[model samples]
Target: MANIMLTKDQWDALQRHLLPNPFKVEEAAFLFVKVTESGDFECVDSWCMQPHDFDYQSAFHISLRDETKAAVIKRAHDTGTALVEAHSHLGKWPAEFSRSDLCGFDSFVPHVRWRLKGKPYAAIVLTTADYDGFAWIGDATDPVRIDGLVIGDVDRLGPTGLTPLTWGPWEDFDGHI
Candidate 1:
């Protein structure tokens, strides 16, 4: 797996869309970014998941309409881009990937890959400050963790070769920015 690059604007937009109601119950969002996978993964543009894509979803889980899923797969196949399925984890900074998440992807991710003619499929879970994500580069049930998310010059590293990063004690409010 390789690092995923997001332009600052794209990154901020995603964060805003996903984190708006963080104080409340969990909400999920999706992004289908234009990806280039030469040496690494690069997302140059993105499409945010819309309101209609979700139905009576919950704070703990998200489900896409079958049509929405089919459309995204078709688009990815026609346009030739990787698909990223992202949602939020409302309660923690360094959120853990729930067993529920795994069960959901065991089938969903592979189907998306098949539809896209083997284009990469990724599942990402974000928190207020960080995220955990993995990618299925091949047709395996397991995934290789993403390497990192590059924002400008810094690397928000992920669990690629090593274990996921742990958050240290934090201050609820940052007086000094």
Candidate 2:
């Protein structure tokens, strides 16, 4: 079996929290992960998408922004963690990065590379129904790989499921680490 880099608790907490949003206004969330020398990954910090200078829908059209981008960078800097960016897709999941996602990456990765001196970064694609993530190494357009999540307790398809992770509170659970 391939080694599990992220812990079960982390997976559970992420599933218990983050959820998809269906509003027309675009929403975003910031995430950071601490990567140990041994290659283990742990959550460091997370922030919900707050309305910034850009008009809400404008962010959706332009992709994520510098303030949010800076939050990701700050978390990585503080914890010596690799950067991980996550957001909700409401109820959709495109097979590949959308034009906006690509745009967001184009603006951020170069900053991350310069700040971390070329360290690896991760991106998480989430929906109210399911979840997946990617590790962007050499190129943002081509992720190293994608992983379907196995969230504990919560059924991906159930009548009374919580909103997708983004709609929930931003939490830091030690158990999740």
Candidate closest to the true structure, highest lDDT: 1
Among the numbered candidates, top TM-score falls to 1
Residue-wise C-alpha lDDT for candidate 1, range 53-133, written one tens digit per residue:
765456676667788778777776766777777777677547556655665676687777777777777767778867777
Count of clashes, each model = 0, 8
What is residue 151's positional error in candidate 2, in angstroms? 5.3
TM-score of each: 0.79, 0.60
Candidate 2 lDDT score at position 122: 67
Q: Cα RMSD (Å) per model?
A: 8.8, 11.1
